[model samples]
Target chain A: MKTLALFVVVITGAMLIYAGHDLPAFGDINSPSYQAPMTQYFINNSLEESGVTNIVTALLASYRGYDTLGETAVIFTAGMAVMLLLRRRER
Target chain B: MSRIQESVIIRTIVRIMVPFIELFALYVIMHGASGPGGGFQGGVIFGAAIILYTMIYGIAEGKKKMSDSLDRILASTGLTIYAATGLICIVCGGMFLQYRAVPLLPDPAEVSKYLIDLVEIGIGITVLAVMISLFFDVSPPESEPEEAEE
Candidate 1:
């Protein structure tokens, strides 16, 4: 069992390291992500479009509001589930 | 916990620090648009404050501070706030979650910004409620009968 676990960990680590090479180098301006039109659009217009200086916040809360809503619902569901599972009934 | 309660200095310091921790959490949530924070981060910090309170004090005392009923209400309220904001936009003849359609504000950008802040606040409330509730549910009061006897 120990050997099997070690083998699995080594294989996963190797796969991740192999895949890491395909990632763009640190802060490469000419990277594909930086060149994407959506990236440029968000960078140039996020402030004027959302009136928020923080690009990430504007993106998450305004541009991608639906996703955040779903996230909030997910947390609410988790809380409800915990309550259902652990709460004691009044006798 | 018994050791923690015995140390007067530790208790005093924690009591003082909890308010500051909570204040910082609020600052993070409110200033998310301008700085590097938002609902989730702030909510976690706020939850941490309560958890700290629970740790230093007892679970019973923590329950007194934030009862189960209050936790559920706050959690539901946050989700309601998020959904209602989106529904209002739909009623205004725009797509769901579209802030530009809301006519309360003049500029589209300004309206979007305001709605984003509201959404952030809702998210923070939900996250904070859920965290505290989860902690309490997982570690319930084990001394109910002992207290009842007393």
Candidate 2:
């Protein structure tokens, strides 16, 4: 059974690596995402729109602020859950 | 943990290093707009400094610095800051989190820059609080509370 499982894992890993060959090269302008107008628009306008030099920050904190808000809530929830589970009761 | 606590050299190094680590975290959060780091990364770093201190000093001393109530309060407060920033945009007659809609400054771009900073700060606070609390919660209580009866 263990040998069969290892065989399955090895085959899957090999297949994944083989499939990864079709992926676009680093920073290829012809990549599907780079070809998209939305990506170009963000690149062109993010600095002007958000006055943030860092594109990632503009994307996270301004363009997609709602998503970040949810992410923050998720972290808070995780902390609360851990506290409830692991914290000792006061004597 | 006890072995480290007993080392004067280790204790002194950690005590000296924590403040600098915290300061660097603040720098990362503030410069998120222009640099590689953002709230999450900075918060994790900040929490790590505390965790390092806790690992050496023990959980009891760690709790004294960041009590359970304080942790809860800070975690909620960070989330509140994020939500409030969005709500304020709505109050300013813009959609939620519409930074340009805020009338804080003459230039909408300028307003966005500042609001983004505010949002980043909110995120940092929440992430920092949560990371510390999670560490405290997950780690075993190696030292018993002083008040515990024998």
Candidate 3:
């Protein structure tokens, strides 16, 4: 198990290093992370349409909420599993 | 907890500061749509409120206010609100949570924008509740109210 873990970590580190080369130039202001496409769309349309001040908030709450919902479900399942494990059994 | 209770000065200061911290959390939750803050950030703040309750008063007192049953229900309810909202979008004859198909208002494009924010609120609540449950599950047995504080 320890060897397997070490192998997994090494492969993950290698993949990250490879991917890092193609990454968007370490945070350029005009890069996709900065002034990219989707943020602009949310900024242009959702602000006045939704009457929300923060464009990022509007995007997260509205556009990507489905993904967020799935995340919540995942957490709920984990909590339930833990409860089953730890809660004392009835005599 | 024992340390905090032992220090009179820390106790007085935290007691005074907790309300203000909680107020900031509420502000984060409410004003999430306008700025960098939103449901997720605000929800974490809400969890922090409970953490404060646990720290100062002890886990038993905290657990009195929030039991295992409460955490389970909250965790489930949060997910239900989120999933149900998505199912509503599907029932309205759209793809899974595809807001354009939901017929929210006369101006289809307009509602699409607003629907996103509402969905985000549901997401925030669910995620926060679940995270709190997870936090407690991994908490040391020393902190388990049934074992110690109770």
The CAPRI category of model 2 is high
lDDT (C-alpha) at residue B75 in model 1 = 94
Cα shift from native, residue B136, model 1 (Å):
0.7
Give a tens-digit lDDT track for model 2, residues A1-91.
9999999999999999999899898888899888899989999999989999999999999888999999999988988987877764733
User: Is candidate 2 or 3 superior in lDDT?
Assistant: 2
Pairs with steric clashes in candidate 1:
none
Off by over 4 Å in 1: A88-91, B143-150
TM per model?
0.91, 0.92, 0.72
| I-RMSD for candidate 1 | 0.9
Per-residue accuracy of model 2 over B26-96 as CA lDDT, tens digit each: 99999999989899999888888887887787788888888878888888888898899899999999999
lDDT of 1 by residue, B1-150 (tens): 467565889888989999999999999999999999999999989988887787777788888889888999999998898999999999998889988899987898889888888888899999999998888776646532111100
Collision count of model 3: 6
Cα TM-score of candidate 3: 0.72
Worst 10 residues of 2 chain A by lDDT: A82-91
Query: Could you give me the TM-score of model 1 versus the true structure?
Result: 0.91
Of 2 and 3, which scores higher on TM-score?
Answer: 2
Tens digit per residue, CA lDDT, model 3, B98-117: 66677768876566656655
TM-score of chain A of 1: 0.89
